[model samples]
Target: MDEQHERADGPFRARGGPPWRRGGPPPWAPGPSWWDHRADGGRLPWRSTVLVTVIVLAGSTMAAHGRAGDRVGLDVFAYLLLVLASVQLLWRQRYPVVIVYGTALCATVYLAAGYPYGPVFLPVALGCFAAIVAGHRYAAWGAVALLWAAHTVVGHWLYGYLPPPGDGPAAWAQEAVVAAWVLAVVAVSELVRVKREQWAQARVERERAARRRADEERLRIARELHDVLAHSISVINVQAGVGLALLDSDPEQARTALTTIKAAGREALGEVRQVLDTLRAPGEAPRAPAPGLDRLPELVEQAAGAGLTVGIGTGGKRVTPAPGADLAAFRIVQEALTNVVRHSESRRAHVQLDYRQGGLTVTVDDDGPASHAEAGGSGNGLAGMRERAAALGGTIEAGPRPDGGFRVVAELPLAPPAPLSEDSR
Candidate 1:
């Protein structure tokens, strides 16, 4: 009755039953049900149908022979009960508990009516086995207990059949054998139920792990695209404004600004294509090497061309960092310089890089008032810079300077790259 059990049994629906029939399968099948071909290994229900039929026939024949001395022949009513019980097994997968309870009731009636005891109990045992395999644990055990109680009460009143009959030691030994058989069925069913639950839990864990991996990959791609577009587009925007301002008064200056815009547009296009290639074919190597701290001189030259005076400073011996840390450090400086060009009124900017034993520190300062652009414009630039630093276990700070300008500082740990193995080289 649990939701999980219902989902597990979803593949086992009966076909061609009456319109009024709701839960259980129809009494007889005109042909094979759709689920018969899909169950377990396929054709499972068909095989079970054949096996149960054979068992009923062979059991009835043996029972008729065993009671020949008592003149108790196999009667029409006895044959009819055996046929009904065996035929019901074809729907065991769809309605396991229903089949078991239905068959048990029939067997109890036959016994209480003083019919010859034989393989009439075979269908009842088979139904319980089917219920267990379908993950109906409580229902199977409950049916077992109820059937045993019925057998004891009915047999005692009609034929003096108790667990330990009143006849003597011989009768007590027979009852002990029947009790052991019943216990074995219940034990086997419990072992199967435990195994089914373990397999289902393992499948769920695998799906969750796959979803987590996909989410992380998407975030990485988004960060790369943001860095490439923000830095490049900001430069183009500044150059375009300068070209428009000097178009009539200073033709020569306007020509230089237009030239800078052309170069920035070309560079931005190539970088955008590279980022898209990585998304399209992730297994291939990147077309161009990633920019890093070594490219800062070129960056400063570009800013000077855009009419901003920039100065660079360094301290201590230079040390190389792992690829991830190098990329993060480069993006932090690029974003800061982009902000200075687009948002600040200052024309002069100073950048300092300090290399320490523990890590590397970068600071960028510009002499400008804190405009509304710094306070409230879309925060993507600042947010992207912070994300890059945090990914490499670093930190970044950006705010107004006490003297009168804006300042940005970042610290990044220098993680050494792993040495290549002989086989890899």
Candidate 2:
């Protein structure tokens, strides 16, 4: 495992980076909000501030010139309109609707008061953009319609003038142009929404995959622990039984039994630590050599040392199998031997391994008491061995044999089928 993925006892930590900074800005921080972080005191760039200041100054100059010539009073209302509209740019993302509608109203008033189109119309158009970025598509369209209607109604009712019949087409055409501009804004914002949704879903899938992998790793660790601990414990159980029975008659042999117990404990601890170290960092731990068919003789010898008459025989060339198949073979034999010690009343058992061309076959038969059949028929051990064999696409059969003994026979494929890697499990 990588250091970033180390499994410590603590709060859960998210395993990936933020969604932003991947080419385009994330949807939540798009448009004006992207620049929101760049501003000092949350103010616009100096260039925009200077431009707005220059526009206000130019508007005041025009109003002052007109007032001096006695053509109009200095339009204090117009100056206020320009200030209100320009200030709205600052709050475009925070209060998009309020700023847009406010700027639109100010622009309408300024235009109705006979101010030039340059400064007044600029903010009005920019407000439409702010509304789109805020995802108010319908509201923006309504605002566009209202602007056109207000321009026509104010011109006719207050000024006593209307667009001529042929001029009506030109007026409607201008409304269409504004509609197209709003439509373009809507299209871009929707694309950003879709991109953000996909990014969010991808994050969810990645986390789900990580959790599944962690769970599988934990299960694998449990299986390894069961295999290593159960086998060694079974041997220790038989050895301790013999040592206790012969403590007075065979003192030296009993001391040897104690030594074997110590050795088994040390071996079990080392196996456990090796498993933990590998899980902690797969590359740091050395791989332990896997047990296979060749180890069956040693396994039988250990059982015999515990005073159970045991026999192991190989029927073929004893070829090495693939790793998965080898592990399955070892587990099958281990579980069978464990059952013979735990469940059988008889002291004599046979362990056989046949390495044929199609696959390897394992058989464990014990001639325990005739009534031992009823005692060991719980089937849990057998069921687990069967499941293990089935997982490797193999077959297992276990029950009472005809000659008053329990027999377990399993045939495992030499090469396991390809595992289902695509599935998260």
Candidate 3:
């Protein structure tokens, strides 16, 4: 029977994994494209290399022409420019500031030397994209702005001609067009960065909330187990003692003690069965009237029956919490009173239950100084009570009272459950 009971309620038998992911592997098993480090950072190094190779070949092809072969000097310069720009791609992410600056510098030099701008500028655009994706938005935009300003300044002063084609109005239009393109890239990159940060923060908050709910659920299970087991165990201990003491002098009384033992065990078995029935399908209707604020009188009577002098008092109106909130309040009071019975040195303790418009407050105070220390050091009773209160967005404070005893005060909100109607159950 004990083995059967163990099998019935063992923690290891609890269901594992979320309902959605219970059957299969997640989608990104092979990993996503953004995290791909292969293909040389998707950099197209061979494009630059081939571009330079074409420039070299073009210069060689034009060697037979007249002063056009002198124009081949420009092709050679473009080839060298491509080589330098391709090298910048390798260190783009690791040293984005250096790479952006270097690319801009080399492009300026190649342009000034009369090198062809088309082949050399391809790597510059790639470098700009790389800088933004590397997680440096502000710096990337700053470098772009600085580069544009330098081009405008240098073009009007150092170079003999304006930066692009046409006179005053057309030239200004071209500059505006280029500036808008640069700003568009910066805006897109910044949007992506902001979205990534928001997503990460939201995920963290969700995980934290899930963990809090899991902890509350675990504490609720523990309270139920304790309420069932502790009473049964205490009764068993009392009866076993009576049986041992009456063994020789009163054999009939010893038999009566054994009968009481059987009755206690049977009661324990019934409660355990009820708990299991409740656990098996939580979606099923509740089997018993939930213990709540109304049950405090009954709880005190039970503690008194267990041989502790428990007192009850009230300072305010009566409280009727929502089903879950009431259950939490009940658990906190139950654990506190149980500790007074099991751990106090003195026989006397007072339980104060206060109900206000704001919330329900329960406080347990014992006249026994060092009751907890004398019985045993710290244990899970107080911790469980605090956890129960916190589960309901409430608070619990337990410590030595001013009157030289232990005190436990718990305040629980009177909020109702969302889906359940107040009149229904």
Candidate closest to the true structure, highest TM-score: 1
Which of the predicted structures, 2 or 3, would earn the higher lDDT when compared with the native?
2
Select the stronger candidate by TM-score from 1 and 3: 1
lDDT of 3 by residue, 1-425 (tens): 11011112123236654322465323212112233344133454555545644653454335424344222244455556657766666656556656676776776666555443344544555566666665655556777787677656554555445323332222666567657867776777667656666676665455545555555455566667766566556545656777899899999988877776676577667767776777688779767676677877766655654556778888787756788788777777777766776676766788887888968888889887554444332366676677677767789998887878789989888894344332442
| TM-score of every prediction relative to native | 0.72, 0.64, 0.57
Q: Write the per-residue lDDT of candidate 2 for residues 94-210, one digit (tens) a residue.
A: 556666677778767765565544445556566666666555655655665676667656544543332122222224565566557546655665666567657767765666567
Off by over 4 Å in 3: 1-91, 115-123, 137-146, 158-180, 218-232, 251-321, 343-425
Model 1 over residues 1-425: C-alpha lDDT tens digits? 00111111111235433322455432222212324443333334767777877888787779768876442466787777777888888877767778888788877767655555677777877788777767666677778777776666655453544222342222545556656766788787667666665665565454445444555455555666666666666676777778899999998988998898888778778877887888798699998987788888877877777677889999888888777778888778877887787778888899898999868898999999644553322457777778777767788999999899999999888894354553463
Q: Give the clashing residue pairs of candidate 2, or none.
A: none
Best by lDDT: 1
Question: lDDT (CA) for every model shown?
Answer: 0.70, 0.65, 0.63
Separately for all candidates shown, the number of backbone clashes (residues 3 or more apart, or on different chains) is 0, 0, 0
Could you give me the TM-score of model 2 versus the true structure?
Answer: 0.64
Q: List the residue pairs that clash in candidate 3.
A: none
Q: Could you give the C-alpha RMSD of every candidate to the true structure, in order shown?
A: 9.8, 8.3, 10.2
Candidate 3 backbone clash number: 0
